[model samples]
Target: MTTFVSIGSLTGSIHPSLSGVLTKRKTVLNCPIHGDYEAEGIYLGSILKTQTKCPQCEEDQREAREAVEAVMRQEAIKKEVEERVAKSRVPLEYRTKSFDSFRVLNAEQGKALELSKRFVRGWEKAKAGGYGLLFLGSCGTGKTHLACSIVAALIANHQFLFPKYYRTSEIFSAVRKSYVPGSQTSEDEVLNYFSGIELLVIDEVGVQKGSDAERRILFSILDTRMTSNKPTILLSNLSAEGLCSLLGDRLYDRVRSKCVPALFVGQSMRKPATPDLFD
Candidate 1:
């Protein structure tokens, strides 16, 4: 038999009554959701406030991760662009010059091209030194053209060649600039830069009057690069003996010992406004 209890029978005692239906009116101390209901976790009830993560919080976390990834990608691209800019030093005059500019009218010109192609193909390995090139020849004979061509190939195809070009005058000027008041660059800084690059092209080795001071500067650059096992490409418009005299005995010995010799002898490829068609 089921016993039925009423308010008149048990006013101040426990009674058999159904659970009350919860409503929004009793949710004064309710959680953010499921008002006046039960929940799971510490202080488990919907009436008390909880510290659970909100939808907005989760979205924020995901956005933060994406932002970090974006920053990393930007930094990587920035580094690559900086490296490319540093490698590009070809003058506007020679910017468009390529292997196609040369006619290879003689064995020496062809040989220079073959060596350059090999260097470009093998640069990843050759950049660590042991093999370097010395392009000793007259101006307009395509020495600079061949050297610049290598730069073009690497820029177009290779990754991180980091080639640098400097006329012998510009090189010494950098060192001289350090002595000027308020200059940011130092001599050692310039030296470190030239010595540490992947491949350095020093052009016009004896373009002007060769003084003992100039020879000393050249000696320091060459000697440091040699010691560090960095390959260098040298361009000049002088004969071997003349260049040796300009470099002096000690520096020439160091240069000749490490570099493969190539003599570029040909009619000047430069078209006088009328062009030099004579071989």
Candidate 2:
């Protein structure tokens, strides 16, 4: 059982069996809100020092510490995501694009916005199914805008998704550079890097010369990604037929199998700045 004992002006409770070995004391202390309470004091070899901590106060301190730790953990995750975004190589101009900032000037733009948001909302399902999107239309039609928005949303919300954004020309350029004499990188290395990304967005698809070499380079990356069930986004100014010719029958079939077309039709959002001659 338990027994309560008084040591000078303090009171403490201990089991009778521990009376000889353990020295425990308690002092009557007044808490601002809890009123009078007994503060437990323990004596080792030195004089006993009373710790005036109320039970309720300790609980409050514990909760505060937990809240601080939670905030710190959130900050760490945010930092990690930011670093990954930096390494993603998103173009500086499109880095700030998001669904909220996309302009909805026409019915098609509105539909495109809704589709992009749904894609982000169903990211897990899309990733599992190897589904992707094709942003097709004329240049300045906000194709790249929506593409970057999708990538930005995924990176911000899904920490596990690693996304890469590059122009079709950039990929071709990288592959060509890899062939230079004494080049540190190889063509296979370049293709493998593009193929291994969880999500890849290739912009300006039809800008490159339709050389057989370019076609082969594009085909190799797409084929590998398709086989691995990785999702891809292609931003292009070509019509459906035009893009089909560029990708050829076999490669186009693979893209159509997993990618949904988000047609962005309308005037280019870019407007030339009028000159202020008088100024």
Candidate 3:
């Protein structure tokens, strides 16, 4: 006699005798997708009867699970990027600035942002010939804002890079700390650490006077990273000529040879808190 599995009876309120019969030799199932198969099906609670789901159906379920996992992994990566961008800034002012909050009220600012975005998109290609970005202008022109926005965009979009940001003074401060006796961190170690980053951002390029030692340290950083095809971004309240004077030809030459320039000429973005200063 042909055997048939009453899926509803097996999955529904089970009689005591049904349980005894089920525990015996495996029951056979006839599914539309896989024809006949032997099953030692698990007792699913009142909600579902998957006795019809044969080995082929289980394979389909496995594929569905893998697809969901892939989507979850992508979301995790994006969340990590957002977190790192929030924490990357050294100055507190630009920490919260994002591309959305940045105002593009004029064409120059718009172009600056456009170029910054292009830099982020072509970053993988930069590792061969190297790419540098120089943001030059007076204070409050949003050069630093645009540069920070690039970092946020890059972290959100790319997986390989972890970038660092430093003001010109911070670069000196960081090196000075390494000079302390028994600190176990040498000056070369500090320079090498910054140089090895996938992207290095230095702000306020001409903010202070530079010494021969400072120049050597800075040159070592830019030269090492450039030869390895790493990218760097420099922000300043100075023009190209001003930076040339501030960093000197040896260092300035390296910057000029590799970097793309953006000039910002406007009133400071940092305004007085009083309303009258604006009006």
Best by TM-score: 2
Q: What count of clashes does model 2 give?
A: 0
Error of 1 at 55 (Å): 42
Tens-digit lDDT track for model 3 on 1-279?
224444433535767545422222246777798788776544433223344448778988899999999999989987887778766763567766777787876777888888887887787776556887999988888898888888888877766667888887888888989989888899888988888887889988777677887777777888887777788898988888888887778778887778898888767778668868668
**Per-model TM-score on C-alpha atoms:** 0.65, 0.78, 0.72
Candidate 2 per-residue lDDT over residues 1-279, each given as its tens digit: 213344433325755433343346677778898787778766532355445589888888999999999999999987886677667878778777788888898998898889888988988988898888988888788888888888878888976778999999899999999999999989999999999888999999988999999999999999898878899998888999999999998889999998888888888898776778457
Better of 1 and 3 by TM-score: 3
Score each candidate by Cα lDDT: 0.74, 0.84, 0.77
Stretches of model 2 off by over 4 angstroms after superposition: 1-28, 33-38, 43-47, 156-159, 270-279
Candidate 2 global CA lDDT score: 0.84
Ten-residue region with minimum lDDT total, candidate 1:
1-10
Ranking by lDDT: 2, 3, 1
Off by over 4 Å in 1: 1-87, 274-279
Q: By TM-score, is 2 or 3 better?
A: 2
